[model samples]
Target: MPGEAPYLAVADVLRARILAGEWGVGERLPSRARLAEEYGVGRNVVQRAVDRLIIDGHLEGRAGSGTYVRSPRERLRLVRSRHRERPAGFPLRPGTRERGRADAWDAHSQVRVSAPAEIAGRLDISPGDLCVTTHYEFLAAGQPVQLSASWEPMALTDGTPIVLPEQGPLAGKGVVERMRSIGVVVETVVEVPRPARATHAQANLLGIGAGDLVLLIERTIYDTRGRPVETADMVIPDRHREVVYEFGVDLP
Candidate 1:
């Protein structure tokens, strides 16, 4: 294509070869010097192309060894359905069926943390209002597959048994149930999902290369009285999972 970067052009050719099985999985790719010579481009251009492939999950770079074709990855299905089980007293178990059995998750909660402007907006609270923030990492078979950062206004849960999200009697119970425990009834949940690239910090946590594709879901839960009870940002890696949104239709 006209005006395309030289490195990008080189990357296209190399990507084709990889997809065509010119290099088998775990097979070491030709050196950058050799590829540059073969493609009639500078070594820097070849290096950039290889880096692109690495970021795209097609190749892996060893510390001392050269880049090699990566093994195929299995993408799990992550369903976002409106038909979630809402048991009054039972805490929803961690993990989902799509992620495999024995799925587990860990969470770290910080109390009395001030909500940032964006989070406050999502929760319909003041910018500096005290809130409880919890960071969660969901793993399947010991490998991290998803992450979420949740925030709830402290004013609502303060002095209550559910003050700390991951602690107390209602620990591990979802936002809806916990709020119900304190006489707050949750009625609705809204989620907006957007595609994004992984950042260095997010990549480090999910064990993916930075610049890889990911899905960011912004979720806000509202109560029966139209008050925002909780908000969260869920991150799912593109290479590791496929997101499915299911909705039910009502007939008149």
Candidate 2:
């Protein structure tokens, strides 16, 4: 196309060649200077194209060596099951075991944080209301697989042992168990999953291209009385995982 960016045009050609197997997996690509001369563009243009390909998972860079084609990675299965246990020690909904073995996760919580408008809407609370906010990173085999930001109304757990989700005796216990300890019986969970493009920050954390596809899930947990208890937004990189939804069938 006329007026197209020179780097993008170079990237398109390089991508096509890689897809056509001009460069086999693990095969090193020609030097950036050579590519620049061939494409009649500056070395910077070739460098930009190679950088994009690296971010897109089509290539890998080596220190003191040239870039090489990357091998395809197997995507892990991340299951979201309605029947999974959400007790004190079990994972909530998308259990870590679904991805294979025991996955590791770390969470940081801030007390009395003001809820943003979107989070407030999901929790059915007013904007700027006090809330306990938690940011989580889930890892599989020491690689990041998922990220989540969760919010809980402070009014519900004020002065309670479960006020700080990752603190107190119930530390690391799931939302259901923690709420139960405070006399709040969790009844139902609602999740809305959608496709999204990774932002630069998300891409950096997930080790994927900035515009790569990711699964965005908006989840909210409700109490027995239908009061919203906790809400969260989860981000799963499409390059690394496939999400599956499972529900048990009841017989009449």
Candidate 3:
């Protein structure tokens, strides 16, 4: 298109050179002013071009440093199941393989939160109902890989030992075990996955640029009677992990 923005044309030229290996991987490109002089365009045009490449994952900008070609990221797989989730150590006891290397997490829980409208709808409860909320940050191989926020209705667990998801006797056990301890069987889990732009908070924690692509998963667990016991939102940085879903064949 002849009417395309000048910066876009500049970006195309830069991208071609980068892909053609003119600028070696991890090598900084010429200064914006130098690039402008070479391309016979203004420095502002060169900067816009560089910014476009950055957003396209072709280049990276370091604060107080120049832009350089982006190196390939080391991506891992995070496989989830519609079936039961046992403890990571359950391999010897019979269960699916665990995901992530040296998986670890930090979490905090608060009591008596008012469920937001969206969360309430997911939980099939009235808006503003009392609930317990927990925030989680998960790390794999010493790097932050995922984040989640979970809410559980206080009505079900107020006086129980498992009221707090990560406290008391069953601490560190997942939602399934904790609820099972309280005699509430989690019969089903539903996950809705979608793409989103990383927010400032997510970017800071995941070590990525703001507005980067991420996978957002909304999950809800239900009892045998179809009553929701908990709902959570999981955020996964796309550059770090790819989600896989596997199911066993039914022999009906």
Candidate 4:
């Protein structure tokens, strides 16, 4: 416990130094032995301190280089947009009314063949369930802005008439809309946000570099009776997409 205490103390000291600008971005930390001597702790304690900093994103370690402070820009500050309108009718570019057709959902590439654990759990389905997934990358000025994937339950969609890549644009009709036409009324919409990495397939689908920053927005559509119907995962590039929220308050 005492050894761990020193490590924690050293971690706090270094974290404060990082926040106070004692170590600039990408600047290397002192060597383990040097840090141990500086902090009057053993090398292992110093190493633990450094590990904690790395996990907290205050420090980074390069394979061939030493531990260094993380760049401030690497810290993502998510900005949600304030606009709320129809979901699927917006043009690929701003200020235009071009219709994005279902054809746009065609399989330009296969990102993940198996349903990821998180997605499967959200959809109340099994992993690797037969799902047709499409990766859609929206670009602005030739850079990837947003990456997203729409998934359908194999039982609900497999062999169904809607599985064709040509049916892509229809997926955005909100599962509720699509279901309503089929006499299924979606009663609930649940959306959750978190940080995640792009799998190999997702990287290929979105045309983003591996391990790049992304925002995972998971949405689950449920029927009127509270049965989960459809789930979608939207990956937004840190620099490309904006999130928005609107609040309605009752006047006193």
Give me candidate 1's TM-score against the actual structure. 0.91
Q: What TM-score would each prediction reach against the true structure?
A: 0.91, 0.79, 0.86, 0.58
Please give, for residues 39-151, the per-residue lDDT of candidate 4 as tens digits. 88889888988877765557878887789998753322233332335468643234222222123332343423677887778777898776656666655445445666666
lDDT of 1: 0.89
**1 or 2, greater by TM-score:** 1
lDDT per model, in order? 0.89, 0.88, 0.87, 0.64
Which one wins on lDDT?
Answer: 1
Span of 10 residues, lowest total lDDT, candidate 4: 95-104
| Arranged by lDDT, best first | 1, 2, 3, 4
Q: Evaluate model 4: give its TM-score.
A: 0.58
Cα error, residue 249 of model 3, in Å, equals 1.5
Tens digits of per-residue lDDT for model 1 on 137-241? 988889888989999999999999998888999898888889999899999999999999999989999999999999999999999889999999999999989
**Candidate 2 weakest ten by summed lDDT:** 93-102
Tens-digit lDDT string for candidate 2 (11-51): 88999999999999999999999998898888998998898
RMSD of 4: 7.3
- Which residues of candidate 2, in runs, are more than 4 Å off? 1-16, 31-55, 61-67, 86-97
